[model samples]
Target: MGERRSTSQSLVSWTRLRPYAMISPAILVFCLFFIYPIGYMVYLSFHDWNFVSPTKEFIGTANFTYLLSNLEFREVIVNSFIYTFFTVFLTIGISLLLALWLNRGGAIYSFLQASIFSPHITSLVSVSMLWMWIMDADYGLLNWALNLIGIESIPWLTSPDYALTSLIMVAVWKGIGFNTLVFIAGLQSIPKDLYEAAELDHTPPWRRFLRITVPMLSPTLFFLTIIGIINSFQVFETINLMTEGGPINSTNTFVYYIYQYGFQFFKIGYASAAGVILLVILSVLTVIYFKVLSKKVHYR
Candidate 1:
């Protein structure tokens, strides 16, 4: 029996088969939830089909061409890039700082960490509503507090100029908590031995942080950066709920615009085209990022 088992293991390569078989369920789920819909959306992108209509006509790349020509679509694309850039950048930097502060391990650290992470567990719609109330120039908590401190009330969501910024602020505030946790995990993983070695050499705090901490934490930072960018790209519900694309489409993101086209306006085909384009953009950027940054990500 032992010889038979050894022979089977050697011949069948259980190690290789086990790993593949273990992840088969996850792969199946991804195919069902992610790949199939994406493929269908791509197929739909080339045609003109209304959700209510019975027919779908092939228009080749006409839908994409039309989207490119549409001034509003162009603006949406630009807005997506801008929104993604600012929010992801700010989220990473702010989350890192907060993580470092919370990593100090004091009586107040637990309270602060929990408070920051609280929003991450809360519902997005609820969070948006809370911020909407907070940003009210006339009666919102933000402006009311500002008035008490001699600061003037500003139209946060009402003004097109500030609407996008306000949305960005709310997003950053909500997401920073989760990112902070990832960063804290990274910070905690750094060995005390490294810090002790640095201290022996009389390394300054900032220098030790830069030389040891940043390098060691690069893997977590990279992960958070990718996740942050992806989340910011898909920021539809919050903007839709809070501002409904805003005073003049200022906050209409790619996903929200796609949603508006697909479901709201019944332009299913056109929206599918937009979705496929976004998928392509995301896939390309992700590939480039991993190709470039993977080598630099320090993993211990």
Candidate 2:
């Protein structure tokens, strides 16, 4: 009886430990890859080190102070905010429109959906290169088209006035398909019976949409808004491949600024400090997002 009781106790203990044992590998991997890198970056942010340096020199918050005082970094911050604002809102707005139009089941709708989403699945390198050709001021497709209509060629990626706008356009085009697909899913999940009831009361189309559709899609909107902000803030490939933050740093954003410092300039500590700033900005945005937007998200 004593042996049987001991065996039962061991079985209960094993059952209790099973879940943690199953999840231990994932937790370990997360710590190694995610937590460790972030911690190291934080540590590096406080010291001065070029990539080729044999040893790091303690610099305290000089990196952060320089970034704060630097005019170029301020412009980079402005550019990031501008790019993020335009990209996120345009992607969400246009995609919501497209989702509404294409939500029905039909072969033509399916084909159109696939066509729109094709750009999203394409590599960013390819997209950047293709857009470079298209937006080239001389002998480019955009210029050619404009010339045919008697409009002079406008420098899309070259002029400071239009360079950031051009990047925002690329971001929106690439992101819209995914946002639209998600919105469509959200729309489908909403109860059709509610719509039927509204229709029975002879509700206006606009009223039905405002009263039913918008509330039902609140959750999707909130999700896409947060994701869009984060992705737009981290934009790098398009700027790197297309503009290289050129035309006098007109297109220089946060991620590219960090890259320019870390890899191109070999200012590892400076870049790390910039990275920490980015992390803090994102964390604050996320917290504000939850605080301000959570109440508005309808979860039904």
Candidate 3:
């Protein structure tokens, strides 16, 4: 009888632990890939180390101080914010308009929607390469088209004045299709009865949209806003491929700045500090976004 009791107790214990055992691999992966890297990055931020160095020198906050006081780093921060602002604003605004116009059912609308979204599905590297050719100062499609309209060739990526603006344009163009599709989905989810009820009161088109449509889309708008801010702040591929953060660092952003310091300049500690700053900024922005917009989002 004692032996039977022991076996039953052991079985119960194993059953209790089985779920945890099943999930252990996923937990291990999360720790290895996510938590470990972040912790190591934080550790590296406080020490000076070349990529090939045998040992890291403890520098405390010197790396951060250098970054904060550096004029180039300050400019990179400004460029990042400016790029994020324009990219998010234009992408959301234009996509919202497109979503409204294309929300109806039709073959033509379907084709147009597919066409718009095609750029988004294509790889970013390929898109960057294609845009490079299009925006080339000489013998580029954009300049060619402008010259046809009796306008002089404007340096799209070569001029400091236009380089950042050109990057913003590419980001907006790439993002609009995805945003529009998401907006369309949100619009469709909103019940038709809401509009019908508003129309019964002889409401103007704009008033109906403002009262019914806008409120219903608040959740979608909030979602897209947060995502746009995060993605825009991380813009790197286009800057790297198209401009290489050139035209006097007009297009230099946080990620590219970190890449330069870490990889090109081999300043691992400095790059880690920039990475830490980016992480902190993103975290603060996300928290603020949730706090401000949580009450505004109208669910179902």
Candidate 1, residue 177: how far the Cα is off, in Å: 0.9
Instruction: Please write out the lDDT profile of model 3 over residues 59-162, one tens digit for every residue.
Output: 99999999999999999999999999999999999999999999999999999999999999999999999989999889899999999999999999999999
List lDDT for all candidates, in order.
0.91, 0.94, 0.94
Candidate 2 TM-score versus the reference: 0.97
How are the candidates ranked when ordered by lDDT, highest leading?
2, 3, 1
lDDT of 2 by residue, 1-300 (tens): 999999999999999999999999999999999999999999999999998879999999999999999999999999999999989998999999999999999999999998888999999999999999999989689889999999999999999999988888889989988998999899999998999999999999999999999999999999999998999899999999999998899999999999999999999999999999999999999999999999998886
Best-to-worst order by TM-score is 2, 3, 1
Q: What is the clash count of model 2?
A: 0
Which portions of model 1 show Cα errors greater than 4 Å? 1-25
Supply every candidate's count of residue pairs whose N, Cα or C atoms clash at under 3 angstroms. Answer: 0, 0, 0
Which candidate leads the pack in TM-score? 2
The total of clashing pairs for model 1 equals 0
